[model samples]
Target: MVESLPQTRSVSAEAAAENRAWVSDLSSTGDRRELASRRLYDVLLRAARSEAGRRAARLRLAGPELDDIAHQAAADALLAICGKVETFRGDCKFTTWAYKFVIFDVGAKVNRHFWQRAGVAFDEEDWERLPARLGVGPEAHAESRDLMAAVRRAVDETLTAKQRTVFVALVLNGMPTDVLAEQLGATQNAIYKTMFDARRKLRTALIAAGYLQEHQPA
Candidate 1:
């Protein structure tokens, strides 16, 4: 059994065969690679459109604009996937892994679209969202003000400048990770990882400073 994959959702033999064929065709030379790429591009386009469809209403982008986002996402995903073809290990289905690429591009595109639609700029004013998440209340912690102050310091002093920017933009300003990534000229994966590290640092600082109540995961 693959430790990373649950046995419950086993990849059937037929599915595995198809995945292998995708790899073979995609990794082929000349015309084969071209044809395979076109096929994969179509699949990616559909996946991106589906992704956009799921969020069109929330992003308030529909009709041609949403389709345009999906098209751009598919093109981006195709380039990324083809450029990194050697990295496909076949641990998961080819389609499954490729889907992630499409999702990443689509997510970034959608996030930027949403941000543009909402006019959410990352500013000092956005920091307002952090304080509420940090403090419980006057009754929960007598030194709520100090705890909040400590959290602010932790945010400023503990995280790297980039980390601080990403966290503040995404959390406080309600800017999506993808949009923050675009503004920072970074990938969504990189921004998310930075956010993860920043959150861990903040959690430790908050717990140490007597702000958040720590509870072990069950």
Candidate 2:
């Protein structure tokens, strides 16, 4: 036989009084206690499993694991509500405050887990600098990788040691002109000229390899 769920108690007068006392304590410094409480409740409900799943999907978190992360974030939000009750000054909506806390908590948890498993510091500044130094976005990144692979093949087929070293240092390593000069034992002006020539040659090679096409300026 199936068991029935237990009935919940209705809000009694004594319970209501106790709640009012708690709220009054929370609003001690002339804050909008009612609004803050309401907003917190709304945020918690919105971050329920289904809604969080949708958000996680948008953020590209897939499979059963993402649900676990969402649940963890929801729990963290609830804990924050209890711990940060005094800190809620109602300067902004409680929902906004709760969301910031939840996102930070979830991101930290994920980063920690990844670092432990991979044995690497994923938050390195150099990792962030790589993409910006490449002058590429996510879409451009894929294309850039493909172009790099083709260039490597072409380099193996034809370029000499000094040419390959200069090309890799300036282009792939994203070294600045001054740094490239230091490494090559050349003047900054000489490094700049070499880089310009290397780029021209690579562009011509890439065009021949069908990796690039000329476009007219608008």
Candidate 3:
């Protein structure tokens, strides 16, 4: 008898068929691949532009700057999609899957653009926002202040220099992981690992100080 297993979600028949066509055309040789590549790039470009439009105001990008970022994101996404096309599993529509690549590229580009235009610095305002961001309110203002103090001490005393820098920039200043990686000449995975370690250390410190429960997930 066959053992029962968890069922995996599958795309609709129409989505599956479209996905197959995209994979096939992109994987084929010569003229067919060229035409498919153009079509795919257009799709990626539109997705990139849409995301760029959403982020432009916040990032202070406009006109040529916005267009440049969108175009570059589309180009990068196209390359990424081509390399990973074979990995497509059709759990969603091909366009939906493809759109993720462009969106991520746009975010990375926008972040990099911000850093290039105005570099990040340690700001008291950003630090002040942290307590409020953590849901600390006037109801328990005194207790919240204590928690913030404990967190500050943990950040300064417990974490390593690299960990402290990463946590402050990423968690406090809202720097993107990709931009941080570029600035520090580290891999995105490395930055993420450091952030994870920093958070764990802070959680442990908070727990020891009676600010958090031992069973709580960081």
Number of clashes recorded per candidate:
0, 0, 0
For candidate 1, write residues 26-128 as lDDT tens digits. Answer: 7677998899989999999999999999866644578999999999999999889878776666567779999999998887877666545533343343444
Can you write out model 2's per-residue Cα lDDT over 1-218, one digit (the tens) per residue? 11221222544455444444444544444456555555555566456554555544323455676667666766777667657655544444445556777765555444333322322222233334443343334543456656556655665555555565565555543445565565457898876776566555655666677665544100
Q: How well does candidate 1 score on lDDT at residue 126?
A: 40
TM-score on alpha carbons, each prediction: 0.56, 0.36, 0.62
lDDT of each: 0.72, 0.52, 0.77
Which model scores highest in lDDT?
3
Report the lDDT tens digits of candidate 3 across residue range 96-116. 999999998888777666545
In the predicted model 3, the residue pairs found to clash are none
Whole-structure CA lDDT of model 1: 0.72
By TM-score, the better pick of 1 and 3 is 3
TM-score of 2: 0.36
User: Which regions of candidate 3 deviate over 4 angstroms?
Assistant: 1-9, 119-173, 176-179, 187-218
Estimate candidate 2's alpha-carbon lDDT, on a 0 to 1 scale.
Answer: 0.52
